[model samples]
Target: MRTDRTARTDRTAPVDRTVATAVAAAAAIACLGTLSACGPDNGGDQNAAPGKAASPAATSPAGGTGAGAPQPSAGAAKPSAAGSASAAGTRDIPAGAWIDPRSIPLDATYHWPAPAGAAKSVAGAPTFKLQELCHSKLSPDTADLGTGRAAAQSLAGAGGPDRWQAQQTLLYEGDPRPSSGVAQSAHAVFSDLREEVKACAKTAPGATVKVTGPENADYFAATVTVPQAGGNAVTLHEYLTAPDGTVNELAVWTTGKSGAQPRVPWVGPADADVAKAMDSALCTTLKDC
Candidate 1:
């Protein structure tokens, strides 16, 4: 449903075409796949459930994003044991592998998908454009964030102490874009995201966006904090990539109690842990890592 546009790529002259094109594609994907949060519904019936349409304010009808320290694991995982994890390599991996909800680090018993009415709720509000990616200001009005084709977006929120995650994978099985191109695009997205975080500190006082890692070539991630009145806050961390035409993304959001703020700086997962989690989730649908 999303339409592609021909925009200038140079920032000084008009815009940065490379990042703009890439982000527009990604935003279109987000509207359909709900991988990254997007703009409005643009009139089409998205079949989202009717509710108190959520706003762009950190809080969502879906749930609160918490800001707190990570929960402790029982103990450190051994290297050899971690290395043997499935989907560890790029060769011989399966395609369209099923993603087991349990593999994500949340309490499965309380997990739920994204709100049905999510699309309709956030109408007209400018989505968080990766300004860093485009290296230019994007006119929310000119860019149609929704109205794109709907890819199957598998969203779920698990119950736990301030924890929830949304996961979506996109496969370009017959598309013209090559795997290498996809990988390159992923790198660009992450790089811009980091730049956005750096710039946000100055523009959005008190809020923070911290880029974490590539962890390895396949992953690039970050942590976000939006301070609210009464001491409460919304926090989010996400990992995203399109490894060889297959897009794999995971985002976790947590909400802290009134006055409870993030206690420590975020340093993403261990390389091994990231590898294991991505493999376990992707293996269900993909044959290759």
Candidate 2:
């Protein structure tokens, strides 16, 4: 039950500055902990095509939002939080509170009935725009920690007290269409700051994490990220189960590797054996993980 030691996808040597800041702070806390840190998680597919371009951190569910399936497995295993409301409508998600929602990043999924009115934000890195419950259940690594936790804050404008406020997302993939039409994941969510997250709506509650529907977009979404490592405010959550019964989910956020100092990945809760050794080394080097 103690397996969180990985960083050798073939990294060789010369990375020891105290384990390279604890393996880059555990890969920047797993890209701000919980399924994100550097790149390729999600982007594109909110209805898609306003700007369409994420593929950074937090990238999620750019599923086929799934058709041929097979092309939507970039990064989706954050799972940290340990708060324990007992998972049935848990609640905490506010961020900017110095964090500790039991660790955040319950990896994304849930999705049942939520999201009925307004859910579409865009701010990032320097601020935040994951906007009011961007369709509920999001964890896709919170889309790479929403622009490296908003560039790791302290921009001198976030209104004080250890500012680093996270909140990034893109999330899309209810299987709208994807025979590789591109659009792998999106359904992102990050929290650490809060000018106003609408009082943090019952927050956590886990168990496939409480997500709903009617949110917009159709399905099958993706854009890119997860070839070598995607980036940007990182948020990407994805889950699929289609065979007529139904049970699909998506979430995405983006940003990273542009100039450093974005920093976020700081995870400490471990399991899934380093994400099954990063998806069995990404399905043996892209043979399909």
Q: lDDT of each structure?
A: 0.36, 0.24
The CA-based lDDT of model 1 is what?
A: 0.36
| Consecutive 10-residue window with the lowest summed lDDT within model 2 | 148-157
lDDT of 1 by residue, 3-91 (tens): 22232323333446666888999888767765333435443333341111211111101111000001111232111111122331111
Reference-based lDDT, residue 138, model 1:
24
Q: Please provide, for model 2 over 1-289, each residue's C-alpha lDDT reduced to its tens digit, 9 standing for 90 to 100.
A: 1332344622545555557777666776666644343235453344442222223111121110111011122233222122222132211111121112222233222111211111121123222232223223333553332321111111111212212232222222222233221223222221222211222233411112222212232222221122112422222232121111111222233344423332434232232222232223212322222
Off by over 4 Å in 1: 1-98, 108-152, 158-179, 197-199, 214-217, 258-272, 279-289
Off by over 4 Å in 2: 1-164, 173-178, 184-267, 271-289
